[model samples]
Target chain A: MTTTTIQQDLYPTRTGEVPGPAIEREHPTVWGSEADGPFDAAALEAHEQRGFTILENFITPSEVDLYSAELRRLSADQSLAGDPRVITEKSTGAVRSVFEVTALSEAIDALSRDPRVLDRARQLLGSDVYLHQTRVNYMPGFKGSGFYWHSDFETWHAEDGMPAPRAVSCSIALTPNYPYNGGLMVMPGSHRTYAPGVGETPADNHSSSLKEQTVGVPSQEAVTEMAHRYGIDQFTGPAGSALWFDSNIMHGSGNNITPFPRSNVFMVFNSVENTLEDPYAAPTPRPEHIASRDFTPLR
Target chain B: MTTTTIQQDLYPTRTGEVPGPAIEREHPTVWGSEADGPFDAAALEAHEQRGFTILENFITPSEVDLYSAELRRLSADQSLAGDPRVITEKSTGAVRSVFEVTALSEAIDALSRDPRVLDRARQLLGSDVYLHQTRVNYMPGFKGSGFYWHSDFETWHAEDGMPAPRAVSCSIALTPNYPYNGGLMVMPGSHRTYAPGVGETPADNHSSSLKEQTVGVPSQEAVTEMAHRYGIDQFTGPAGSALWFDSNIMHGSGNNITPFPRSNVFMVFNSVENTLEDPYAAPTPRPEHIASRDFTPLR
Candidate 1:
């Protein structure tokens, strides 16, 4: 029998809302209820069972604008994607500027403490919570680049007793997700099974590069909404809309099928069980250093 | 209240009968479960919440041969720790040789599928799990370097869903962890609190060096098992013995006080939820090129 497909729309009127059923699916076991007080059960249960779940409207409209401006500035100086490696530079083009803008922005810090957002994370993460690491995926046509599908843990090298990641905060949508425009796509349940490394050497690429990650077979039916029509979950909407979900989710972003750039700021807040390995890499409080303003609420 | 410290011998005597709580305090959360079939719960859970747990007979008796040999070879090398960054080279005496040894041995490969060990991991990581990275912390006293309390995630540079570290795996007892020999130590619940960064520049010699990660605290009593009498714990143990726990937990090793070199294989692993942002940098597995017969697993 063919497996049923599901999609979810985090924000209505937004560009890419995952189709129905994709948000939640049946599973053999129940998980993540241990720290249930602060999270949306539906979203997390979906994550525990489905490997991933999306919560749209995680970011406010105002925050979206703030991210958009910073993204525009970061990408403004970018020249021709520059081979997918995230580079911190001092050039003067859309792409280069975008990177610079991101590096200099406080947006990441704000999201780290966005009470509205962290409250849910706190529930999922248990009482004590700390910022892990943050990066802005400013996907612009002229400035930003597209990504490949892979798990995040594939890159980490472990020390003893350290906490492995379970949940994540992925905020996106400067432009709504679109099929051709490079919206996000994921492989359902790929989180559990792991393939040995292909013995490929790591490229010098920073966080943004995806081609180097191990690629897996994504579900054909699971990629669509009703009737397998919508493979790409359009995340378009007013700026500042972010989606939060577990990192194990098999998701990928489509190449910006639209003309303009697709921008989003992803900030991950882990449970107190997981702490920042380094102090310098702690999470910032906002999507960008918007007007040098502090958007972090009292945590 | 000062937590009571458990000082049970990490080693099982020849007469030490089957499973018991004696090993629980230092074992990874995985060992002994019903799904894996059969568990010594009474003997297992008897320890203090298992701040650290060890997997008994994790490495085959024969595999222990490799550790003994390698430790012997390094102990003789005297200046093997020549470069601070070199830490200790793979079997070939080259830092880059680790890649060459991935497929080299049967015993090492078996270590990957060792049902006895992976079974425990499955219990901790659910049905799905992926080996995150593998590394060997081979150090002789000549280098005289010691690590301070910190998480392993610092190297990821914080992208992907790869939050700081979740759990750590280290097999102790090249000869058995002891205060005199510089064993590994932990501050137990220290992971429950947040340790802020000192705000050092990345380029600062003090900022990025492992030798510089020192954090000053009043006492070692607050630490779990890693803490010894004087704000320290080497957590050392015999070969073939391993310890796994949360990364944020306060832990570190002391200088090798023993005349013999200290060598232990600390392979880091992660679940799908943890490896999203960075996928390439995981540590090296047993080098495939080297014969398992050539290397030894620590006591």
Candidate 2:
């Protein structure tokens, strides 16, 4: 089974009405119409400077269809130990394991390998790249399946354990995700530019407590208080779209409040500098949390 | 400094007196009086059959006084970012970080190597072991600190992208934590058992909601039910005392209302099976509201 990437560009926009479920047929498109293609040297440079960048037409609408069909096929009788799905807490990742890995479809593979996704990761991390993990989120009843603004790498990068860090995440939306559908909300170009908000915890102790009074990581509240002054925007867009941001960037999403099942696959990528420790184990890097860099240059 | 271990024959049990602070000296002397230790391998074996083991003299009284004195010495300063003596969460073995590798005081060292501790863990895990992380909690005043009931290994064993299984956490309480002092209250042997409950959205979400759910492992209602039935004994022992239980065991502490601080240090241990994948991370594990395993053992 080949991995089908979500690279649809039915609706591309540099900025505007922020396409919702309603298709913008006769509506004037704000961004370029054609697929922007793989991230070029220009896109790479822009992302590093800005902390985040968006790739248009990263996957097609049909490809997203393929992802949904395959996901449906994979969700059969998945009850683990007790219920159809258990709701438990560990020290590490916030999981939804009931949605296990669906064998990557053909279209998914191409999208993950798409230079637009990998090269951008390479540019920020300063090294060769590889997919961290491909994940599919299914928001049932869209009643805010999940929402909380926080950093990703703070849990992966083993608090002050490794050297010369470079880590990044690339998210591709499979459906039209607006703020109402729990779209990815992010602080523009805020990735590599900012200092690690919350200090270091462990790869396992991600959500054990709030960020503020903990270790090296700041609390999400603290990050929000700071991000508010900068005017953060919700990352909403159409299918076949992509987002590249530094692992250290503070980000989160709203819950899908509507009947629509908001879905997205984060094709996370990291450079040699980022995954150097164990390639599979990244904890929060304290130095990055302290510098509080700016993200505009990467763009 | 020489690391000393707790003797096996000293964990304080009911000495025919009501549970109170002054009862510290009323328990029978097992180690110094005789070398039989906390309980013989046979008694421990029996206790294991019944679920839960008590290791006496886990830490010497003198050592407890020393650590408590050290906490008093360091807490005076306003800044506690990296001070090593305050006796907080890091002092408990949960999150792996920079200060993770340090001297294990003789008291802790003893508990670390306790045969009873090992025997119980071996029975629960059915495998070899690795030390995860350690921390100490000084719950003082009306509003004491709170922690979620979760497994250290289940939450933090492998790196985020890696497929390593979970490890387990072993909490060894040094003092007789009672309800009045807001001692720790845990679900009886919930680690070996798991059950999913009805999912509900927490009221607060402006912060680290996910992590809040993780550290606050057990729901308030769940713990209350277990306490009513099994009658959770608050961990309230004198110095050189300790109690061992499963990391994932559903549990939490009450407010510390008495004058003195409610003290305890948890040293986390993991099995070798917990390998890293992302070399730089351990993704945030799934919270209780979204895990996919059978965690309901209470029913």
Candidate 3:
């Protein structure tokens, strides 16, 4: 596509007078061409129809242990105290998420570049892929907070300058994600619809939003309609399992008040063909660590 | 200036055949037009002639204690462990420098926006200013590492796409800077001459360079010539003192093997008119925390 075409097709959000949430159905769920490689016809059909797919034992238990240890080590790192990449819980001051996992850890970086993950991402995006964002979401037992319902693409399009919903996110569980411990919930087939959110993006919104996102969230009515129309599916599985979802998918999780803690190594892959332009909504692009401007494809 | 003129006037470094070290003397040391503002005639004249000026008691002792406490608290923050903004010493693993200090601490943020500092920065750049970079450099006793001789503009121009050397750095002494401990050393009158270093910038150079900068450093011959021609001056002072210097001035420090620790809060202010564009040398701009892309004026 020409640069002008790409700029014009920037999945509109936070625009126009009194912009409010609406279900847009123009964008494609998957952009990749080579569907035969990696994912079989059944899995591809499931993903296309459901907006997400789950793979059991995507990594071995031993690998999960290693990554879990890395998560713990990173969480305890005192040097990260004031760093913006490390977002803390609003109420508990515990680490909510740590962005830029690949750059932070060599092992995780290797995983991001691994063909098992990279090839599938390329096949899904139909182009060379770069990490749009990566993080480790940590939810402690009892006092762990939950994320509000939101579409990742709404924020990516408005605040991060992502031109289209041509991105995929992989969340690899490091700890067993039990239903009671706030496992991910998604509205099947919701990726087919784009829910544009209300309100102008505040400058440096990521500072507060990462801790507890308020903007770019679909209203309760829209969310309830989506749930009723498409039905809700929960991703609850053993450690080492993975969930792959479309960028525009409506997804969120509940508060984990159970004794079991939940943690996942999350990675987002964006098509290099769909690299960022100027933010469609915000005054400036979010920090590179959060919404990476680096379009260097994973080798 | 027009955009074309600004692009043409980019302080060239890491360009042309051989790109060897050379002293170019076309750019101005100070860009501000208002000479009758915060700085008196002698201070302005000293800054223009010597490339730097020191202000004693720029902040009070009680203020120093508060900032120092904040620094210690930030250094001990476990959440920052693997964050790219928090660079640790190569050998010791102690916190070397914490970038984006203003975003990290309310106190430091307030300090950066304070009129005492902000007004002088406006006077130096002769335009509205934004934070190009902010960090707290912590040099622990005995094992603290020293920076190599280089011009900050070299990296800022090549990697950050800064249009010119129309920027100023303020280093506020949070701890007493004794001669025995490692303190800042600058070559007087060197800001008038731009020293282009030899070498192509490695991709993601900040990852390693922050710990111990190897690239973009001037050769021994260049350092010797500059020191002999301009003479070297050390910034040794009691706590709460501040030193403002030109962006292109040659500067470095020695290893501190003494029992005393030296710490300083460093802030870089760039002219808003001279904001970043595409990088001149590197594959991508450095992370926002290190070389901020945010152009919002410090109001």
DockQ per model, Cα: 0.01, 0.01, 0.01
TM-score of the B chain in model 2? Answer: 0.55
Considering TM-score, which of the candidate structures 1 and 2 is the better prediction for this target? 2
For residues A1-299, could you state the per-residue lDDT of candidate 3 as single tens digits? 65554335536776643546565667676665445358876777788788898999999999898888888888899998888888888887888789998888898999998888998898888789999999998888655656666789989988988888889999999888754456787878989888777677888888888877777777656776776687666787999999999999988765543345799999999999989988888999999999999999889
**Cα-lDDT of candidate 2:** 0.43
Strongest candidate by TM-score:
3
Kindly report the root-mean-square deviation of model 2 from the true structure over all alpha carbons: 23.5
DockQ value of candidate 2: 0.01
Clashes of each: 146, 148, 8
Total clashes, candidate 3? Answer: 8
Query: What is the Cα-based lDDT of residue A32 in candidate 3?
Result: 58
lDDT of 1 by residue, B86-196 (tens): 333332343311212123334444565566555555445334445544434555532323444443433321211244344344353444453333356555544443232
Better of 2 and 3 by lDDT: 3
> What are the per-residue Cα lDDT tens digits for candidate 1 across A220-283?
2332221123122333344555565554444444232123456566655555544423111112
Candidate 3 docks at the CAPRI level of incorrect
TM-score of each: 0.34, 0.36, 0.49
**Evaluated with lDDT, which candidate comes out highest?**
3
Q: A252, model 2: CA deviation in Å?
A: 1.4
